[model samples]
Target: MLGTRVSAFLKLSKRDLKYDLPASIVVFLVALPLCLGIAMASGAPLFAGVLTGVIGGIVVASISGSALSVSGPAAGLTVIVLGAIQQLGAYETFLLAVVLAGVIQLVLGVLKAGMIGNYFPSSVILGMLAAIGITIILKQIPLAFGMTETHAFEVEDGGGIAAFTNTIFSSINWGATIICLLSLAVLIFWPSFKKLSKIPAPLIVVILGVALGFAFQGTSFALNPDHFVSIPVVSSFAEFKGLFIFPDFTQIVSKDVWVVAFTIAIIASLETLLSIEAVDKIDPFKRNSPTNRELIAQGIGNMSSGLLGGLPLTSVIVRSSANANSGGRTRQSAILHGIWLLVALLAIPTVINLIPLAGLAAILLHTGFKLAKPALFKQIYKKGLDQFIPFFITVAAVVFTDLLTGVGIGIVVATFYILKANMTNAYQFNIVQKEEADMAVLTLAEEVTFLNKAPIQQKLYNLPKGVKSVVIDGHKSKFIDKDVIDVIKDFEQNALSKGLSIELNDVTYKQKPLNGNFRLKKQKLQKVV
Candidate 1:
C-alpha cells in the first residue's frame, strides 16, 4: 500500500513537471540577470534578488492564481527603494517597512481590493508598459557601455538624453562596448544564420561574453573585472551567513515606518494588480486570474522575502512575459526558475561572476527597445486621441516623475477625459408617464456610476413638480456605484417635500446604509445578481 501511494505521487509529480521543465529552464536563463540587475538597482544585497526569486517561485507559485505569471524583486522599485534606504537610515529599518508592507498587502487581499485593478483603462495599461520598457532601455545604456557608477540620466530618472550625452563624453570601455555592439548585431542578424536561428540569442551572447572574459583574464586585452558580474564570494555556510538580514522590530512604533509601509503596500498592490491583468491578456489560453488570490500570493511571498532580509516581490511583467514567450505553461516553470537561482547562487557563482555587466545591459536594452517601439505608439494613435493622449501623458509623466506619481497623473487626466466623454451622451430624462398618471417612470441606462450622479440628480430635482410617484427603472442597468446610490438617498429625503414617492425597480440594494437610510453599504459581490 505504501509503495502504491508513493508510485501514484511520483507519477502525478512527473506528469505536472514534464513540459514545464524545459520552459522553466528558459525562464531561469532570463530571470537570473534580471534578478541581479533589479537587486543592484534597489540598493539591496545581491543575494536579496535570489531570495525573492526563490520565495516567489517555491512559495508564491504554490498559491498564486496565475498559471504563467512569475513574481520577484522588480526594477520598478529601484527609485523607491533607494529613497527608502536613505530615509530609513538603515537597511534593517527598510526591511521592517517591507515586512509591514507585506502585512498591509495581506489585509488588502482579505478586503478584496483586487477588484480595483479592473477599473484601469486598457490604454493606460499599454502606456504604462511602454514607459517601463523605455525606462529599462534608458537605464541599461550605462551598463551596456561598461560604465557602472558613472551617473547618467535615465528614462526612469528622466535623464535619458543627458545620460547618453555624458556617456559619450566619458572614457569608453572599448572592448566591452565592442562585445555589446557585437551581441546586438548577432541578436539582430542571427536569424539570417539558418542554423543558429533557433538559438536563444541572449544565452549565446552571455556565453560568448563569459568566454572572452576567461580568455583575456591575464592579458592586456582583459576587461576590468569590476565591470563583470560580482557574485558574493563564499567559501562555506558561515560565509553565506549574513545574506539574510531581518527587519528591525524597534522601528515598529515609528510613524515614518508606517508611512513607508503603507506606501510600499499601495504601490506594490497596484503594480501586482496591473501585472496580473496584463499577464492574463497575454495568456494564450485566455484564462482569467483570480485577483484576490494573486494578492494573497504576493502578500505571502513578500512577507517571506521581508522576513529573510530580501526585497519585496511583485508580479513583474517583464519576467512573466519572458516566461510566457519562452513557452512556459504551468506553475512548475515559475518554481523551476526559482530553483535555478538557488543552484546558480550556490554552485555556479564563479561562472556567473565571469559574465560581463555590459552583456546583461545589452539584453535589458534590447527588451526596452521592444517596449518603446514606434509601432506601439502608432497603434495607440490608431485607437484614437482619447487613447493616445492618456498613454502619452502616462509615459511622459512616469519618465519625468516617478511610477506612482506618473500613474496618478494619468488616472486624473483619464478621469477628466472620461467624464467629458460621458457628459455629452449621459442619461436622457424623457418622461414616459402622462400628467394624469400617478407614477412617473424614469429608466436608467446599462450602467451608472458616480460620474452620472450630477445628471441623475438634476433629473430627479426637476420632476414635473406634481408627480405623485417616481419609479426608477434600473432593470437595464448592470451595475451602480455607491455615489449614485447616495444621490438617490438624498433624492429620497427631498422627495417627501416635493410630494413625490421614489421607488427602485428590478434593483436590489447591494449594500445597507450605516444609519438605516437607503444608502448603499460597501459590500462584496456574492453573486452576479
Candidate 2:
C-alpha cells in the first residue's frame, strides 16, 4: 500500500514538472541577477533577495494557484520597504511589520478579497505596468554608473523628481556608464543577427561586463563592492547563523507596526492580483488561477519569508512573464528556480560575486525599454478615450507619486468616469397593475445604477396617491445599482404605512442591490387594498 501511494505521488509530481530542463535553467539564470538587484533597491541586505527568490519558488510555488507565475523580491515594493525600514529604525523591527502583513494577507484571502482584481480595467493595468518599467529604467541609471554615494535620502527631501535628479548628477561612475551603453546596444541589435538571435543577449552582456571589471581592477578604474554583485559571506554552516533575523515581539504593542502591516497587506494583495491577471494573459496554455487560492499562497509565503528573516514576496509580473517567454510549461520552472538559488548560494558564492552590477543593469535597462516602448502607448491610445484617459492618468500618477498613491489616483479617476457614464443614461420607470386583484407594478428600464438615485427617489415620492399595490419589475434591466435598492427600502417603509403592497422581481447579485436581496427570487406581492 505504501509503495502504491508513493508511486502515485511521484506520478503527480512528474506531471507538474513538465517544463524542459533547459527552459528552467534559463529562468534561473535570469532570476538570479534580478533577485540581487531588487534586494539592493529595497535597501535590504543583498542575501534578502536570494532568500525571497528561494522561498517564492520552493515554498510559495509548492502551494500557489498559478502554474507559471514566479515570485521574488519586487522593485514595486522598494519605496514602501525603504521607508518602513527607516521608520522602524531597525531591520528586525521592520520584520515585525512583514510578519503582521502576512497575517493580514491571510485574513484577506479567507474573506475572498482577491476578487477585487477582476474590476481593474485592462487599459489601466497596461499603463501602470509601462509606468513601472519606465521607473525601473530611470532608477537603475545611477546604479549602472556605479554611483553609490547618493544612496541615502534625508527625510525632508522626499523621493520623487528632485531626489532622482540629485542622484543622477552627483555621482556618475564612468566605467559602469560606458558598460551600460554597450550592453544596451547589444540587447537592441543582437536580435537582428539570425545566428545570435536565439542566444540570451542579457547573459552575454553580463559576461562581457564581468570581463571588463576584471581587466580594470588594478588600473585607473576600480570596482567597489557596491558596484559589483554582492554574495553574502558564509564561511561555514555556523556562520549562516545570522541568515535569519527574528522580529522583536515587543513591536506588537506599537501602533506603527499595525500601520505597516496593513499597508503591506493591501499593496501586496493588489500587486499579486494584477500580476496574476497579467500572467494569465501571457500564458500560452490559458490557465485561469483561482484568486482566493493565490491570496492564500502569497499570505503563507510572506509569513514564512518574514519569520525566516526575508523581505515580503508577491507574484511579480516581470519574472512571471519571463518564465512564460522562456518556455516554462508548468510550476516546475518556478520551483527549480528556487532550488537553483539555494544550490548556487551554498556551492558557488565566489563565482556569483564575479558578476558585475553594470551587467545586471544592462539587462534591466533592456527590460525597461521593452515595457515602456512607444508602441505600447500607441496601442493603448487606439483603444479609445475612455481607456486612454484612465491609462494616462495612472501612468502620470505612478511616475509622479509612489506606486500605491499612483494606483489610488487612477482608481479614483476611473471610478469618476464610470459613474459619469452611468448617470447619464441610467433610469426609466413605468407603473402597471393587474386587474385580477388590483395589483400595482413598477417596471424599471434596462439599466439602473447608484447614479439613478435621484430619478428613483422622485418616482417613489410621486407614486400614485391611491395605489394599493405595487411591484418593481427589473426583468428587462441588465443591472440595478445599490442606490435603487435604498430607494426600494424607503418605498417599502412608506407603502406599509399607507396601506399599499410592494414586491421586487428579477433582481440579481451582479446588479448589487442595496438590500441583502443578492440572490433573492421574485416573490408574489402582499396586498393592502
Q: Candidate 2 lDDT, tens digit per residue, 1-529?
A: 9977854542325654555343466567667878877788888888888888999988877777787888887777888999999998988888888988988888889899889988887766777778877887887776688776655433356778878777665567677777778888887787689897666666678778888888878765667777877678688887777677888878798899889989998888889998888778768989998888888889888888888889998998777866776567777788888988898888888877887777777776776676778998898788778778988999889888877688778878888877876665555545455564455566677767677788667776776655567777777776666667677777878878876667767653243367856553343223333
Question: Which lDDT tens digits does candidate 1 get at residues 1-529?
Answer: 9977854532324665665676676577667777777788888888888788888887887788688889988866877888998999999999889988998898899999899999988777777778888888887777777666654333354467776676565646666787788778766676588787556666787887887767766765468877887766677998777677988998899998888888888889999998888778768898889999888888888888889888888898777776666566777788788888788888888877888877777766676676678999999999888888998999999887777678778888888888877754445455555656556677767667667878888888887755677777666666676687677777777876666656766543355556665553333222111
Q: Which residue pairs show collisions in model 1?
A: 153-159, 511-521
Model 2: which residue pairs collide?
A: 442-471
Query: For every model in order, what is the number of clashing pairs?
Result: 2, 1
- Candidate 2 local Cα displacement, residue 88, angstroms: 4.7
Stretches off by above 4 angstroms in model 1 are: 1-19, 151-170, 189-199, 215-221, 427-529
At residue 506, candidate 2 shows an lDDT of 68
